[model samples]
Target: MTDAFRFFLTLLDLAGLILLVLYFVQMGLAAVLPARRLRFPAPAALKFTFVIPALNEGLVIGATVETLRALAPEAQVVVVDDASDDDTGRVVQALAAQDSGVSLLRRTLPQARQGKGLALNWAVQQLLNRLRIDGADLTREIFVIVDADGRITPELLGEASSAFADGRVMGAQARVRIRPSVLSLAPRTLSGRMLEQQQDMEFFIIRHLQHLRQRWHSVGLFGNGQFMRASYVHEQFRQGRLAWPDCLLEDFASGVEMRLAAPDHRMIFLDSAVTQQGLPDLRRFIRQRARWTQGAMQCLGYLPRLWSAGMPWLARLDLSYFILGPWLNAVIVLSLLTQPFRWAFGAHGLILDPLVSALITGVNVVLQLQWVARYQREHRLNTGQVLFTLVSLPVYGFALLLSLPLAYWNHFSGRRTWDKSSRHVEPGEAVPSMNGD
Candidate 1:
């Protein structure tokens, strides 16, 4: 092998090991912390505005709006109909007429569903207009962004409100999960449960990282159940940066944007605020993950700002690792895919050394085991489910994970189209609790 090529392989192996070490370190801290679980103080008194952005969400929009109404009667529910071809607009408009707390915002076709960032920016403007006319305090108000299919409990909502009690916590993300009843529902198959459990296990690890990251006051935001400080969000809207690049990962951009916009503030993870996220079938999961993976890549735009974000060194390091996660995952997958070819053709040295390859693989196994431990301690997963995850990990884990490469390829090839998740939630049906992850 050429000296330069050999150096490249060595460097790649070293970087992979460093990231794995950091990953274990963070998970270890999350594991050993005395106050690991989420706990909440009394709910706080704050004006809340719910912004539900819908694009052809007729299936679940009605139930989502109604649930929020019952959960927070005093909160304003703003439904942004993103030029839906379905009845999403009509249902929300009808509800608005019947209830003063609910309102509707309609957009034209060319603009609607162009991106959620645009829809959310419109809602933020409408909210500002309302606050001005009503003479409310923008700084003290809270803005909650829930997905069209989001199922949040009243308790989670209360905890979300209380998370901003400190005033410096600019954003809070909830622990998101798929409903447990899905396992017993119709058309349930081993593959479907595997898919759901894979995602659930992922959230288990992600929420723990966020919890650890929050100790340094550098938590990131998840879209479905994040609460943002009203003043901070308005500032972003006025700056014309509310939604970045057709709303590429709006939740993620919000966290980075908040840090740059408000130097005095920090973000948090509200483990107590759980949002029951509805999962699509296996076919749909691919499309959804493609968008998410691409969005993570697009968020690299915020990396420059993060360097000067004035956060602690640890927070900056954690955020940097997160920002590069998609690329790192892509590289690792590429390395693994090339190994077989190199092994057969006698160019094995072009890939990782055997010892290094085993080490990298071992790191992944240990992380999976750590996730199992976390699910046991937190989600109270039984042995059967844990075993299922171990077996299913190879399928659901790699399939979703390997999409990072596809996401990068699409972006570089100038493909940025987004497919909205199809809503399938039944009205008034019981959504299993998240118990704050």
Candidate 2:
């Protein structure tokens, strides 16, 4: 082979090797990580206040409230109703009347301060004041933040509270399960599997690595079912406006801020603390992904400060990957398409080496299968869902590519609003309890 051809082959080989390493590392982590189980200390005295920030969640608010009541009867559940045109507030109010543990705090947005973050900030302020006036012990009160659509189980809450018993831990993130749907097409199914793969890698491998290094920087917060030290949250908010008002990916931004503000604090992933929410339909799923991709790129605004402050290498890598992965995949696909032209124009070989392409493609297929089987086994998803994921790989790749431009557009336009996901509750369907991580 000529020098140019040799260099191309070498590059392909390196990419294949890196991809294989990532796949096996994920598999090893999945196998080795223990299943998360919440174990509370005797006489669970620590108090928890659940915060549900809702924006036009009229349809699912009642179900969420009912689930919370069942899971944490002793804990206070506060519903922060962001200005909704629908009957969300009415629903919350009705539930609050029926259950004393439930309380409603309604906030109408000023034209200037309209955003999920602002509403969350308002709620946090109220919660802080309540804790202060009641003389609640800082160490004993935990603030649990759940989304309007979030469904929690009894065991999940139990596990979260147990984590609070460890005084050094600042927060705990729950395992979030996206519900499977029979209506899923190839793209949607593959997209769901990819999301699961990302979560499994983050929760099992990346998190463990961070913990082992003892340079635990908040990577990303699982928004729906996470518990935090109330005092810590209050202190951060007091320093500046710290809520999920206008963020497309508020959970991630909050996690980054929490890590920056408190280097000593530790956040644990409760593999057991579980919450379930409906998967988005194809269009909404693409939009939601685009928002995340854009938010991740926007997080680059913090890179300079993070680097200057001497952030850990792993943390920096984590953030970089979030910002680059989608775009990189797009570039890789484009490069493959242009390969024949490059070879025809030049003196080098015309096509990607068949062996190299076959090896890489085979590895990719195996990795996807491994993840699908693992997720199916662990979650007990129906065989149809598993098969759906297998068929959707190509469609998922296209959707990811589609997200690149959307991400860029949203970031520049300063339109970081939360888009509500479609609900998927069926009559007589058994709801699984939340696992406390």
Best TM-score among the predictions, by candidate number: 1
The whole-model C-alpha lDDT of candidate 1 against the native structure comes to: 0.74
Off by over 4 Å in 1: 1-8, 34-44, 185-188, 243-246, 350-366, 426-437
lDDT of 1 by residue, 1-437 (tens): 56665566666666666767777777778766644454455566788888888898876777788988988888888888888887788778778889999888888867666788777887678778878788888877888888887767767766766677766677778877766435553445667667777787778777777778877767888888888878777676677766323556877877777777766786767665555554547767877887887888887877887887677878778777777888887657766776775566545333557897788678668767877876777767688767776887788866786566667777789787767777665545653222311
Candidate 2, backbone clash total: 18
Q: What's each prediction's TM-score?
A: 0.88, 0.78
Model 2: lowest-lDDT 10 consecutive positions: 428-437
RMSD list, candidates in order: 4.9, 6.2
Best by lDDT: 1
- Tens digits of per-residue lDDT for model 2, 1-437: 37876567556545645645664564455445554443555534688888988877776777888888887788888998878776778888877888899999988756322655666777878888987998988778888888887777668766766667767677777766554343433644555555543433334343444333233354357577767787778777777747442466677676666666655666667656455554434566677678777666666666665666556677765655554555554445544655676677663332467897797678667766765676577668687656655656566567656766777677678776655555555335544322211
